[model samples]
Target: MERYVDGFVIPVLNEQLDAYREMASEAGKLWIKHGALEYFEGVGDDMEPDMDGMPMVTFPQLADTESDETVVFSFIVFESRDHRDEVNAKVMEDPTMDSDNYEEEMPFDPERMAYGGFRSIVSYE
Candidate 1:
């Protein structure tokens, strides 16, 4: 079966990881509650990989992160593109997603965040 996913790459400050985690936890729950098949958010643990010769753009470089910032890679999965749209619409209407409820500003820079929707071309299990 083909799946739809919304991916995000965000640059977050080291100190704000806790806050980001808190927000992501709530958001993940909401996504699941709204019909997302799966939700994941992971912080950068290993930024520089030993390619043994091959060079490629890293997450830090892609996010343009500073020394004090780490990348937060997140994705939400759905059965299909229409399912994603339905779940997202419901999630947006949830009170917990409201920006007014937050005490502080967003943990990451919105302009630097990369977002995309994808359809799975392959799968295992």
Candidate 2:
């Protein structure tokens, strides 16, 4: 079975990493409660890219991370595109997602965050 995913990458200030984790934890719980199969939030603690091979754009470069900032990569998985849509609809309506609250408490800059949906091409295991 194919799975769908909503992914995001955001650059956060080093000082705000802990606050970001708190927010991501709350969001993760909400997503799980709304039927997301899995929710992942990863902070870049060691983004040093090895130059042993072909170079590629890394999370730091992609998000233009600064020395005082760390990058966060996150995702929510669903059973399919329709399932993703359904879950998202519920998430939007949940009072826990109050826009004003988020705007005030967000740990990162919304305008600089990257977001997208993807369909899994292959899965092993």
lDDT of each: 0.92, 0.91
| lDDT digits (tens) for residues 48-88 of candidate 2 | 77878977898899999888998999999999999999999
Q: Judge candidate 1 against the unseen true structure and give its global Cα lDDT, from 0 to 1.
A: 0.92
lDDT of 1 by residue, 2-46 (tens): 999999999999999998998899889889999999999999998
How big is the positional error of residue 122 in model 1, measured in Å on the Cα after superposition?
0.6
Question: How well does each candidate superpose onto the true structure, as a TM-score?
Answer: 0.95, 0.92
lDDT value, residue 54 of candidate 2: 73
RMSD of each: 1.0, 1.5
Off by over 4 Å in 1: none
Candidate 1's displacement at residue 49, Å, is 0.6
